[model samples]
Target: MFKKLSVLAITFVLLLGCLPMLSAQAAGNATAKQPGNSNPLMDHKLGADPFALTYNGRVYIYMSSDAYVYNSNGTVKDNDFSALNKINVISSADMVNWTDHGAIPVAGANNVNGSAGIAKWASLSWAPSAAVKKINGQDKFFLYFANGASGIGVLTANSPIGPWSDPLGKALVTGSTPGMSGVTWLFDPAVLVDDDGSGYLYAGGGIPNTSDPASIASPKTARVLRLGADMTSIVGSASTIDAPYMFEDSGIHKYGGKYYYSYCFNFSGTHPAAYPAGEIGYMVSNSPMGPFTYTGHFLKNPYTFFGVGGNNHHAVFNFNNQWYVVYHAQTVAKAVLGDGKGYRSPHINKLVHNSNGTIQEVQGDMAGIAQIANLNPYTRVEAETIGWNAGITTERTQAAGGPVSNMNVTNINNGDWVAVGNADFGSSGASSFKANVASATGGGKIEIRLDSATGPLVGTLNVPNTGGAQSWQEVQTTVSNAAGVHRLYLVFTGSGSGNLFNFDYWQFSTGGDGGTTPPPVSKVEAEDMTLSGTYAGKITSPFSGVALYGNDDAAAFNQYYAYGTHNFSVRGASNNSSTARVDLLIGGVNVGSFNFSGTTPSVQTLTNVAHATGNQEVKLVVTTDNGSWDAYVDYIEWSQ
Candidate 1:
């Protein structure tokens, strides 16, 4: 027998260090790329379940802000919560820069209907899907999202973000009803406005952990319900749309004569970091809601040929006729480097439509950039609860944090107030306060008030303390509602110098819809046509616009520059009819403008070209042109 082989202990040590090494290498790779070279037409982390619309030359991104929390690394902090089940609109131009339009109010806190306050599911809002079309004689938007903690609910407003109201406060599609208790009713809504201007909603994808593992393995049982034209209730029996495997965060796209269902599996919806992350795949059907047949996959592990991980929560948005995919990538080394938190940063990639009209993911680039048409208006803010002590007194107080408890600060003299809490109350609701103070002298009292943009004394209360180790006294009061939505403060006022008190909690209950939110819009206007340009070198295949040539000889392979009306292109190849092997740039950034060449010239086309807004510029450069054998392009027309 061969000498016994011992697994080297040294090998184990090396393997242990592999994780840190790999992590460091990954982080370093992201930073090694040329800065500002590979960027998206536009980008942002403000919206989720991104729904986009291009109307009258403007592109708007509609989504829910939900809640604001620190990424584990603590790099980003803000109060941009959708403000109580509200929808937010962000508009952009060039698909690069964006502008936050604020929150689109569907419902606010303490409203007769909708979810708000300290309720379990009321931290922020959830998925919001939007469709814009003309109803009657005027243009209207149908924005749909689930209300309550877990079931499907309906709210309507003429605009994307609005003073939305639910005439019926019950679940539009009941979740886990008596007969359906086998599963937890879930809601991640996606809306489709058909050619007839009729609206149809597709919702489902939540599973109760109580189910047997075996039962969960079967995808056929997963539900996908269809809503009628009104979208107020369900139509036909809830049907299982995605076949073969159950996938959540589903989106629908109709091209040519078929409907494609883009979805992701392995997403648990709760802790986004749950194991087994997910993979992006699609299903195809002849109708909007169908017994979709799972086709091939789209996005998988960008680093490995066979490994698939971290691609979920997706949407298909089109700006100026060009399609793009907005999805969360599991891999975000930037956030990891910045803070060590791993929640993936949002990503948007250009999409290609197959000759048959099916969509494909653009490839080659691992990272892209995004810009906005306008700046997000809300000021980003963060607050942490801290312990407070009254001067020379053994009295200390705990900060009441979160929505349920009213925040308060105490331990001060009369005419003196102190801030005990910090948070941007970005909605309409009642301000709550509670505290107690010990009276150092007779007639000593503690008062509570608010000092905010619209405040000086929101509402006050005089709470008397009976002195000496007395149980904390309660001070209950509600502040006035501010006009629109703005930051709010909770203040504690007390009487008698040197007298201090302790605050318990403070919160604001949103009332009515916070206010209006418009989708991000770009200042640039759509260009009417593409312009001819020159090239100085050999261009990559799958390029757009015109392939410039240094000499009319035309056969030259170098000095080929390509130009296009838009900044989107595929890797190795394209699906539209533009040019290939041309160099393109956006503000000096070399976002890939060409694809690899193989066989025939790859197709390239442009959509949503912006009109020359005085502030922006578009340039195309060519290095070499591959003549005859593989034709190069010069420019494209608006109509292709």
Candidate 2:
């Protein structure tokens, strides 16, 4: 539970506006090509219980990160519930471009405050719901969560991303607590604050041991309780509502003058998977505490249609004058490729209500939501603000000796990239790029590419040895054409056979016309091409920027040419320690060792080499001095 701060209790009043009507065909197909965000808006991690809170102008989605017991396979690793102790909070104004706000501090057993450590909830943190209300003229955000059916807890903060504290240094509801003792699953707590400033807490569900037939037929119930004015304690006795077949994941909200109670249920009759991971069912009542009328069904499981599905939890809210439904699915292929188990990711889609005020069923889409506004590159943008990324991960470490843990891109290697999408640079376009970075093994550069990783290079920020990885330094590079709204990929290049560097944040200046996406280039991946001495592990989407890592001098190999002289270029990074020379070999013979710069990757061209066409294995042998030991290679390309 979180401590209270000053938060003005604000009432949610639906704003009037014209919205695009939803076609019925968009309801059942997970591949539905309608206007919506792609599933797994968060591809880097697994999250569940996606709760949407529209505070002020931005919408923050609070969820349970699957790292607690995360496994790439469909099954939770060792079922270690403690791994789910933390909660992730990501926000977006346009509902498409999300900014990760690190994590919400949920303390575990005997954990210290004012720091980001593990062990917040003893059992685990699952199905958390957050709401911001005005308290004494100031706005305060309240986070409601549970430790995997162990008990229910609360945490409060002045802002969504906060210095959180338990209102009560323990769970607010427990199994031994009066009416709660009868129910086994005392988790998935959902809290709703009515416009009248009244707060309601709903929890308790069925035991998930489906193998034991006796457990399946056990009577199920999801109850609601009136929370105290101080919200830290219960105000009255729990009222058991008839949420038929409601297994768990209870969510409540007030919309269109009606109290909408949404939850996960086993309506399919066949217990498909454990706990019958099925569809989202709803029930409506006139009062927040009511005799709810089950409204049949609204949303189906994406796993059934798209081969990627899991237990579903969701939240519905209106943002930017339009209503949306936010839910989690096993959208990443890591799970669906197997038996359809493992972690879940969040997704958003346009939610339109029927003519009679009943919301219609919705499906997942690739387009996501439309951009709310054009991004002004002139302002500072966090490198963590990623629209699409490959071969990279993030971490929270002390920033440049500062106590504040800033989230930055880690695990950087040759070819890794982060793409910030749809940046609108009006007519004045951008002229330069600046970035704050750190690297233990210094020397590497950021190629400012547009649209794709190998797209048109607009600018290059050459990085100098800034002391170490956590050692922060700002580097700026000039650009010619970088204008308008398009995907910008920051591709990392350098020499080291190991990690390249870390990226903090970046910004662009208005000086030149924006560039356009470059046409595709033809080249073979290192994993598919030749192999030789001192090379590192094969690179993959993990660092989407490149495909391979060269360690030192390699054995010879062949690369084919069209029997005539043609120019060719090399793309890759090198060891951060030195500027080594790599000899371009054709038909297992030496051409010359190209003098590559330090760690950062750069393009080097060799003109007029004649060879026969079919496929020829290209070899890159190292020619290094005592100081310069090795070099890295991404791809060997021939000029058009």
Candidate 3:
């Protein structure tokens, strides 16, 4: 009996020892986000009502900012959308790694630009839509948003990630607008710029007010209107789009010369076999101002895929010759809070358009679409571009003399790291790495790793105090054994610290050869190079020894070794009253151009110019003639 009791006691102790392991297994099962999953785009913040814009080989997603709301007891409350006065923006070139461009303070009492909002007249902003049109040979971006359920407002900017401003200082659409008398909710705008450059705006949703069942079945509340040439103004009165079971969330896309109008199906009444409640349904029309025919639904409700039900919102776009749809789900919130609480995060999946003009039904899941392209690590990559990360946040700040407001990775502590997916270091491998960084306190070390955060260590860059957090400087470190395509991880480490450093952008060098030695930082004097054309001449300058000056002249530097992408800086000046242009060519291929106006000789640097390997002929050609006055060149520097 004593032996049996001892055996039982031992078994009990062993079972007690296994409790934490079983509990950990249960916690791991509850984690909605998994390693290598591309869904939700980012885990640092929550965003909803995703709209995508493709420009210059990148896809930019604009979303309504969804933040946590807390109860009086310090627990998370259901999302009320009261703090949704800002719109978040993120972009990706390869789809797997997304760069957080920060948020646009659209409407609020205080904002990034100033105390007043970008659109100060509007109290709330939600469900944003973005469109870019070339006006007067320059691209102009327009952002449209819902001002609660009452009206719609528009903001304009010079770039997609904007420091935007209200053009009219008022709402664009309201109850009094012509032909909008029946719209139950005048919001959720979607804009499309057709192939012919004509722009159309699709807005409005909600069931009709009549008690007739037909009204609920076919609520003719959605509206489409012609946008003016400027895209900021309405060209004509809105027209009705009689969509069946219309709830909200209007989406528009053109495929195979046919217009598709998609919206959420209303859940108020019994949905027909053809229409399911909370799913995304669509209609087809030949014209933008549509007398449409109801088509089939392409996307089901979130509950159908994620096991969590909520309102449906989406945007369909063609990026890199492939169709994709970005939508919002409560997966992240549910994973954290055990219940979603209505907080949302954006997700993306492949969208297919069948050959017959019908869109293939999209199956939304945690596994997203494969990356279409590999990221080039040779060029300057924004530090905020992340595939996965832990213990980090991003903030908006301006890079020194940068044209637009930029975002930097911040709030980094020990063990924090950011990863970039599928970074192609090429066959030559990388010899060195550099980053624009700043630190207010004692700085930390950046551990350059490959594959995973704990993977092979390639190099380490020690960051130093740069006086202030915004006072930036370029720091470099030698890299070795980093080649081919791998997930690049920037792991942070330091002694006693709360925060370490702020990172802006980083680049890798290939030494202009396959060698592991760091590339020489040198300049090729333009005056010493071979010159041609009618006005080619050499002159003496105080800034630089001998300078090359000419109009319609070309200076050639032979046997110049260049690899990957490098910062090309030209020290020159132009006395022309108008802007003078100089073209840079490598191996007869035009890489880029530089424009200068004033006579003051200063350095003009162009970052991230792609170059081919081996020895090549580099040329500086004065393509633009500024009267008899010529553009002067002192020397041309690369990778300095």
Candidate 4:
């Protein structure tokens, strides 16, 4: 999927009749591979060579941006891999709904930052592999990408979806690197951080040129090298692996105390019964740097699953204790353009391991894996976290004082909307809704709906002119009859044409009196609370003027309110530790807790907490010390 192919124009025009049939199918139908059906992940854009990274409770996927090329006459041209210079990042706690983090400007002249890429010397970036390692008490992320099959470049960031930078300012692996001799096309890197805190890198693909044709069966073209303690440098020279019928895409994973070295078999010559052409084959070994034995093929070519075959690229990883494989196909492009023209989009399917340590054959199709967890609507959710979307696009922009960059739902017009799946609004239901929005032009209305885009209308938020597009304002509206687990939709409505407004994030409030009055949800900013403990202090961020951060730190809020069961939620960041947690105490009695993780600030809730009426004290105490003990708390909300 990383390489380019030439397609005839006549063949493309002849396949135009398939679009009508595809469009006629219902979205929820099993045969349809649309956004709601969960096949190609997303249909708005194209991406390929998907690599997965699991941190905390989320799975982040890094992909090579697959923008469609065009002929001079404005017809779609074949994907030539020349326009690929950026990497797309998207993540989800639930596998079905994903949050688009936009693209990382990796190479070439015009990056997303308006200058040269993070790696200015590289011209192309493709087939990215991402890994996270703990260094100097904090998590450091490393991204290895192919610089057009000639070399591999590395970028480092503090977060998975990064504001990345090239630490070395050049390619990390080149043909000149030691032990790279006899290696053809030194790219397609797969990295592993072993359980022992050691790192290993696997790369190098393509068949060797020789007079003896049998060399195709054992190319010996793949290389394995030990990564230094810093994970940016090499420990020693590289070592070669004799992968049978190896072509491209070097994949590695450790399971059942054994190292699995997998690759895509080459299509150049005749293959044996054991090795299949253009399919993924694996070899097993006891060590990361291995004298390995060839196993069996698990995944067939994309043609077997989607009927549109090209080169296959894949990554295997474990998320939420379940094994899954992410690969690319031309399904989305073929449905829209009638012919795929070698353009590709990413897809995921479940992978199973037999008790004997052998992998079960994977079945790849339009139906993807089930959602591992339900989404919490009571917290602030990014508008880009979409299960399905229509007539809209996302862009990376800087909020007034937020992170370096944040993605927002944009390019919205009338009849456009975004949907989120399996949102648990609880038995009490939601009473109100809030959104962070902005607009330079006349603003529009956001209709909160259930199930489908045109489903039941629960509430509506009228957006106003916010001075500028980056100027954000929090707006709220009363909600009614929004309860239980169901798909949530934010439908945009407006007058005139072009983009109406930009949506950053949204949250819904529960436990209000079902009436015309607004929900009785009370929010207390962290900085305004009384702080105690040795390390507790206030910090500043874009979302809040002051936020609380510390280990074993406690913040107390004393207020007079009605005695009843209420939902308690907090907005915060985990300081890059999965074990971060905060205990909620009402009048000095522990009621429930809120868990935090990942670098991005999000909201987590502890619902149905009993509070006594009259003046009472509520406290939040950080209980975990695994990370830097620098976890943050932006605000706490109580809704009844």
lDDT of each: 0.41, 0.62, 0.76, 0.76
Off by over 4 Å in 1: 1-46, 66-86, 105-124, 176-185, 207-214, 221-226, 267-277, 301-311, 330-344, 356-358, 362-640
lDDT of 3 by residue, 64-156 (tens): 865676799988776655576778888886777888887787885345336747887777777899998766534689999988777889999
Runs in model 3 with CA error above 4 Å?
A: 1-33, 108-116, 210-212, 401-403, 512-640
Q: How do all models score by TM-score?
A: 0.46, 0.69, 0.77, 0.78
lDDT of 2 by residue, 1-640 (tens): 1110111111111010000111111111222212134455655455567889876346778887544234687443422334456788777644555667666657566563234543354545777888776554345788888776678888888767776777776778887665665665787788888977789898877644544444543435678888887677887678776766566678787777989888776432344332333567778999888878877556676565456554556788887557888876655433323432444567788778776767787766556676654444555667776666665667775565321335887777677677765665546567777888888886698998887778899889898888887888887878767776676778888877666888888877653322122212456544555565554445543222332234453533455443223456776655664555666665543543455666777777753333334465567666544355555666666642
Give the TM-score comparing model 4 with the true structure, all chains together.
0.78
Across 1-640, the per-residue lDDT of candidate 4 in tens digits comes to: 3342221231121111001101212222222245456777766566788889987556788888756667999887866665677788888767888888778889854453358478888887878999998766457899999887788889999988877989998888889888888887787899999987799999988766533467787788899989998888888899889898887889999999999998887776677878887789899999999988888989988888988877778899997567999888888777767767777777899999888888888899987976655677776678888877776677776665333457888877877788887787778888988888999889999999998877899999999989888888888888999988888988888994677899998888764532334346899988899988887877775355233356557988898854334678888876664646777777675666676676688899865444444677988888644554556788999774
lDDT (10s digit) by residue, model 1, range 416-494: 3222212223334344433333343443433333333124555565555545323344444454543232223333344
Model 2 deviation from native, Cα RMSD in Å:
23.6
Using TM-score as the yardstick, the better of models 2 and 3 is 3
lDDT of 4 at 519: 43
For all candidates, the clash counts are: 84, 59, 0, 2
Error at 209, model 1, angstroms = 6.4
